[model samples]
Target: MAAMLFGGLLASNPAEAATAVSSVTVTSVNSGDITASVEGKSELAEFGEAVRDEAPELAARSVSDLAVDYRVLKVDMKQVRAQFAPGVACVDGDGNSRAEDVIVAPRNAENIRYELSGDAQRDPNYDPAKQGNRCDPDLFWDEGASPEVDDDPAASAPVRPYTEKYASACFARKSQWKDIYGIYLEVSYNDSCWSDYVTKYDGNSSWNYYSVKAPSSCHIARGTYLTSCGHGVERNAAKGPVVKWDDWAPAADSNGDCRDKGISVSVGPLSVGGSYTHCEKQNIYKYAEDGKMSSYWKGKVTGTRATQHQVSVRVAQNAGRPRWTHWINSDACVCYK
Candidate 1:
């Protein structure tokens, strides 16, 4: 079993209502594992079912030796105000009081999961036993309680301040395997990344934005070695030029033949590109069977002209029984107006 925590906060205005707050907790369980208590009201219990129906492809991709489950809970507004901003009354722009409700769903879980699994399957070094599960929880708020302003100065203003909300999550499995001169070896691990709700207020109108970014796994196969080469994305930005990446080398023994190790990245409308470094075959006489190597790359998307952009990272491996080279990729997307 594994656990992860994600949180965020938004400032409240004295003249307006405070936004409603919500949270989600994701847990991964193996067959017949001890189940955690499901907290909060069960009114939104159907959320999990909705996810399965709405994102069947994602559900399929998340499958592994273990199954994934999530629970969505409504947050207490009083607690939110006390913790983030005390003494602020909650109200809406229309001068009428408001309350928070779970108004939106998570974004991009299907596309991200599909790409991660599909890309790995397409890799020449892919290993079925190394695959793992992914779990993403979705929670966000739209309207919330606001203080009433009798003589509000902004009431006569042409446009009112409005806030737009967005949230997303993605998880990937990290696996490793080796065949040291006929001695097969294998191991599995899980990794995850997530973004809580992102709120943007521009004195306009409110709308829902669903953008999610997540990491994926990579593998290496060659000579007497066939194992998962870990891959990761350091940042999942909705809009920006800075994103970081990490790619690891395949584990090999003295008799192993590994070469051509590197990482690559691609953004919307851009071709796949990265630094490819050459790794000279280790001296076959070196008896150690636990030697490993690694490589790293940083990627940047220069422009923000596109309304929606997809970011992808690929790690290349040139090792297998027949010495074949292939690339595995992790993909994510962002949408803006």
Candidate 2:
């Protein structure tokens, strides 16, 4: 369930994380997708939650497991010995902190079960087993449970799970206020299929990063990761770094497409301390669905890469609720090819 592609960072509500810049060298042009370290960047900003048994039952597996809205069930791996107890640094961002995870994807991988007649959304009396079923499809992860998913689900068999939609961490701006509530050290990835950790910027704002220095020298050129089509930049969740590129692994592309593909985010004439001479302008982010004000958390989930939750039996299970809700304004950077 892990092809490759990565991300990190979480701050606010006493939240914090991000480490590797000590000499900096997070290289992975395509180590078949990706793999960087610092304990894989704090295991990708680890965070957890799931002990809501008022019917939100979640007991066995290990890392994670829970389901109650695939229209109504399919994630109930009843092992009930004892579970749900992982709240590490919870995706804070203060003053309105945000953190909620429940990536229990396993049976058919996830997002199947639509035929409801109203539009054929699955549920045409969808009976993979019962109504309260999130996944127990009849367990068979490669043998014990982990081939990525599907031992049954009517044997629809097919799961390659991987979701980490945009937000490549490395925000800098918070300058003294006690490091803006300093707590830095989150590098997440508990299988990540349901992620949304925002710290905005923990390095203290006013940045102008530029990387790859020479090898093709970043900016969607050289070997080519993108430099045309929409070009890049659709990240205005709060005015900064939108969908730069993450169709999944080599751009991974498992489906959780960053905003509207054709990603961007290099905007610069950017001068603060001074530098960034010019970077033309790549765009995206003018959203105004106006549903009467919003916090839509930015939208756009293309096709093919957002399917996860197949390695359970707990250890901090978040198999794949791969979410990454971020925000930034001015002075943001991400370039690695």
Candidate 3:
């Protein structure tokens, strides 16, 4: 499950480095039992405030770009039980209390560790002799660009100045830590979706401009794709090498429609199909107003286009991209060269 734990406090503008502490309330529960408390000396409140005011862009980051850090402290439950339900008391089916599960001083440890790293090493063996890592959710907050706003009141988008920085800070955090063996909690974060709204859309611009509206959707799938086929602009689930790849935007006309025009794509690892090939027939279609596919494409190629990369059909061409047959489950759809 994803958890979005926003700090309830707000700080001054975060254009500069300033630190302050606020009382942080942490509530933990298992099954239906909840434990809420205001811990001492936690930077959570300060971190939460900085996240809201300073790092608007960080709020737009996907769940993949988030990490949680902090420590978990334990105390003897036996002392408080006499006044409460001392020890691990189990409620019987008839609602009767059983004291067998209760323990007074059952092993107490100070802190635990956790991380979200991909290699799985983030989860370490717990040792009371060692200081385990804690979950500090504030570390994942980035105070870079401001949020993007659309006509929609809730469309708050974050700007990523650099991709690597976003990935390193959130996407690849250590998963877990080892403090006192045999106890751990999996790290989690909320998935922030796109908030920018589309105000105006121009389907027919000399430059094919769509009024350049605000961003409204989170980039669901982004990264490089390599296939024996070339990339098509149609949102096809099966046409491209990877399925459901829909994050690509229209390529600027200035780039010369590098791929859609059959020009070569950046040649890189030959992981899919070694070497380049001409797209004997290349096209990019769209789902139209009438809910029908667009016409076939008219274009040309010159450079050595690589396999399975997104390409755009230029507006200058009389015809647009081909009807995405993959939409109809037709194997006739072509993706690679």
Candidate 4:
């Protein structure tokens, strides 16, 4: 019975509907016999039968003696885009050539200014002696020029600047439950369908573009069982997105279309046996940007993030016995630039 219930809960088709037992009314017959009037779908009927078979003593208990708990799980996913401008030559107050700022326009329309110039004095990450002339790419139009010309007529020439744009895709899913006399018992499992981020580009230039593929899908499954002590138990499991990046190949891939990363996740089991509640959670954040404007002229960038939470609880029956309940909730998001 437990195996069958687990299989049903973990079914791949999250769209399937399964109703829980809502209420159970007890009545006394003229013969002084107690009868339970159960109200719910097949799942609830099976639950009642399981309880009776495991612990016949519970058959005489009234609705007030049996406690049921309900919890809802929700999942969501979304995508966003970021933009960057072309490189430009810059000079310090002393008239010496310096690394130009890499202007980035995040999704919030706010600009994040930074420099890739391998100058120790400017960026602590760079070693000027080892990484010679790292400022040429940001200071000169022709990246191949040797001797690093400090002043060139073409450096001041008019050039196209990067444009700003936005693109996104979103999806959401929630667990279903049955209401039993104001209490809830989760019965059905649900999951978000596969969603994709359509490619989007700036109208001014095809070189400037943004998008994300291989989006994310969320899953939630739950089942009930009879404990050794003849008590009821509910278990839940769920997973969110884990993004993976492709190998970097500049010449073969230009628009960053090969950048779509895959997704994966691993969730441990959670069990609560008493009146206490327990929860486990995980959060992830990742960001990737073009290394050089010349190679990835599109200035594409991306951010992938996700969060997950699993909760479990055991309700105390009228006789002080424990009845377990558990659920999992998660969400994933991808930001493109």
Candidates in order have lDDT scores of 0.23, 0.18, 0.20, 0.19
Reference-based lDDT, residue 21, model 2: 16
Which window of ten consecutive residues has the lowest lDDT sum in model 2? 212-221
lDDT of 3 at 331: 8
Model 3 ranges off by over 4 Å: 1-36, 40-46, 49-176, 181-195, 203-337
TM-score of model number 1: 0.23
> Candidates' TM-scores?
0.23, 0.15, 0.19, 0.18
Error of 3 at 5 (Å): 35
Give the TM-score ranking, best first. Answer: 1, 3, 4, 2
lDDT of 4: 0.19
The candidate with the higher lDDT, 2 or 4, is 4
The per-residue C-alpha lDDT of model 2 at residue 270 equals 16
Give the worst 10-residue stretch by lDDT in candidate 3. 209-218
lDDT of 2 by residue, 30-91 (tens): 01110133322221222112212111222232222222211111121111100111111222
Quote the positional error of residue 71 for candidate 2 in Å: 33
> Which candidate leads in lDDT?
1
- Residue 82's lDDT in candidate 2: 9
lDDT of 3 by residue, 139-188 (tens): 11111122222211222564322101111011111112111332322211
> Model 4: which ten-residue window has the lowest total lDDT?
75-84
Instruction: Quote the positional error of residue 167 for candidate 1 in Å.
Output: 16
The digit string of per-residue lDDT tens for model 4 on 136-235 reads 2111111111121111113254543331212221122222322333232322211111111211121222121111111222222233211000001111
Model 1 misplacement above 4 A: 1-45, 48-54, 57-68, 93-98, 101-309, 313-337
